[model samples]
Target: MRITLKCLLMSCSLLIAVDASAQIPTLAKCTRSANLLACVDADGNAYSVNTVGSTIYLRGFEVIGKRYWAQTSSRYGQLTFFTGLASDGEAWVGYSRRVGWTTINRFSSSGGSSAKFTCSRIAGC
Candidate 1:
């Protein structure tokens, strides 16, 4: 009877630990594709984003990629215009306040070049 009681207690403790772990907050994720940034919160809400230096700003619902640059920061490469209310959303973009940049392949407006890429996500939403 003592052995059975000990096993029951152990099982209960394990279950409680698992439940507590699940309750912990998880890191957010952000995916970058060409000129667009899509961030998903821990609760799974999607939003558009823009990054300048180490700061990320949440933008409108949709982003239009007029052009993309390769292997360079957007600030130096070209002028990017963002339209819509700048609001703070739940999602975070790539290690908040860290210096990181992504390059986008931009083709000439005349369709002279075509750069194709699939969207990929990185941690720290």
Candidate 2:
């Protein structure tokens, strides 16, 4: 009876572990800065980001594809403002078959670059 109970508990624990693992979000690509962390999943379907005070949130309905774009103040609205300074305007993220994926700014015709000057990849930042 004791052995059976132990086996049942172990099995239950294993099942819980598997379920938890399945729910944990996978970080496919990410960019980081002193105040922010922006991550995309393997599916390119969602964005998980950190806002002020170390708060993290997920926004969705995104689809995985060759490229994805995000404009800070514009797309999501006021939420971006509270994230940090310079958290406005158009920001872009893209994926490539050969190079994997990256986040970059679109260059303007007048030599202006819509880039995040201070942010770095999560590995470095």
What lDDT does each candidate get?
A: 0.29, 0.29
Candidate 1 lDDT over 84-124, as tens digits, reads 12122221111111133432222222222223222113521
| Tens-digit lDDT string for candidate 2 (51-83) | 444233323223423233232222232122211
In model 2, what is the error at residue 13, expressed in angstroms? 23
Q: Using alpha carbons, what is the TM-score of model 1?
A: 0.24
Report clash pairs, candidate 1: 28-125, 29-125, 92-125, 93-125
Alpha carbon deviation, residue 107, candidate 2 (Å): 42
The root-mean-square deviation over C-alpha atoms between each candidate and the true structure, in angstroms, is 21.4, 20.9
- Cα lDDT of candidate 2 equals 0.29
**Stretch of 10 with least lDDT, candidate 2:** 8-17
| TM-score for each model | 0.24, 0.25
